[model samples]
Target: METRPRGRDGTGVTNTDAGPGLVEPVPGYRTRVVDEGARDGPAVVLLHGTPLDLRAWDPLVPALRATRRVVRFDARGHGVAEDVPVPDVGRLAADVVAVLDHLGVADAHVVGHSWGGEIAQRVAVEHPGRVARLSLVCTRASPFPPFGELAASLRGGTVDLEALLGRWFTPAERAEPAGAAATVRAWLRDADRERWAEALDMIATFDGLADLAAVAAPADVVVAELDAVATPAHMAEIARTLPDAACHVLPGARHLAPLQHADAIARVLLA
Candidate 1:
């Protein structure tokens, strides 16, 4: 049975394509993909973060799908893991291309959040022709420092999830029963521990600051004013590195902007 994707209301969102289904972008690596929205609109491919699945972008879908062909899928190892290699930033970017090839989409606007944003950068830099534009939310182009210690804690089964959640969102957002913070908490709580740890290790090894110059796509950098990890200044610095990019800062926002500021982000993507 498929896990129905719910909206902010807790009841599931309308399955514009009868809900997400399994598709093998690569043989034996079945991925849960949701391909819906306006059939003739420009393609928009959404990539999710490390601990989250396709649902991380759910809140923004309705707004985009009104006039866009929206495609989102679980990262290779998340959701229904099958025959696949260990997760990493580069391999994860390959999965993005595989999905586009499987869908026969020549190019699309790629949007990614957090770890997903890292994958977006890889796609733009390596497979430049496949990306028309980029929307990077709460992300960075440099090596993330804390992942080393975070990976260690994950390996030791000592990650303070509650504290992690606090960093991800504010108390008010977390208190909302069907809001982003709570939903993220559910995802964090249910994540496969070893895979999560391995993914973090992969992230710790990533160093993309030098590669930004190769990304030729027109891009938008979206960051939260209050996000400690992906700070506004850091995100702005990344924007400066890009050949053509604009930075937008959400006042007092935190890490998960898709869920926290979906409408605002949707406007940026559409603009």
Candidate 2:
């Protein structure tokens, strides 16, 4: 079997490819899809959460490429995905299966963070054979206002983008002009206001919580110790709901654990 690929310094492999090997998973629904890592290794699909794109996974992919086929994409209406979006969460779930089918991957380890996890869970139920393992990071199976009371601020009035960003980063991180927090801040600023609000509305009323019991694949439920957005208590319920699941905590991490604790998450993904 292939062992995990290592960088020259014994860390992780360097991804040198400039990629977005496009695949039209659904007709008229083109999104940016990037394929990386070992060609023959088992596939691993990484899905990003709201207001972010596939680039959110960049920090985490290096750690897996040595021994796994890593695939990531911008979800509908985010990143390079067209302004038009799938109608609802169920359609979002269908896109995941479509991506795998485009790759000719029979099954894969589907890993999602936040809203992405909702999509992962749906696929595990609706397309069980296509998901070998499920990993949910900083996410929940049930419906919860991801933005808390701030969600109302997104509706009808001017969005306090800064306030929305504060929920994901420290006061200090928000002040900085660069770094993970700033990167996300930019994504939100550039996001189409209508689509961003729509994305929020979609998650508000839809979730995979009701169907967790039917998911047959083993699951890895991970939460950020310091994440107020997706609190551990809320995320913990995902593991409890799934028939087979193990929960893990990324210590000292906030909601962006994929960026803050990429190496550790990489270990969990490969484990």
Q: Which regions of candidate 1 are displaced past 4 Å?
A: 1-20, 82-85
TM-score (all chains, Cα) for each model? 0.91, 0.88
Candidate 1 per-residue C-alpha lDDT over 1-271 given as tens digits, one digit per residue, 9 for 90 to 100? 1243554444443333744366778776886777899879999999877777787787899899979999998886566552244566777889899988987899999999988899999999889999999989998777776887897898798999989998977677678877666777777877777777666666677678779888889999998998887888889898988989988888878888887799889989999
In model 1, the Cα lDDT at residue 225 comes to 90
Q: What C-alpha lDDT do the candidate models reach, one value each? A: 0.81, 0.78
Model 2, CA-based lDDT: 0.78
The residue pairs that clash in candidate 2, if any, are 5-66
Q: Which lDDT tens digits does candidate 2 get at residues 179-246?
A: 88777777776766666677666667666676988888999998899888678887787788889998
Model 2 sits at a Cα RMSD from the real structure of 6.4
Candidate 1 overall lDDT versus native: 0.81
- Maximum-TM-score candidate: 1
Task: Kindly provide the TM-score of model 1 when superposed on the true structure, using C-alpha atoms.
Answer: 0.91
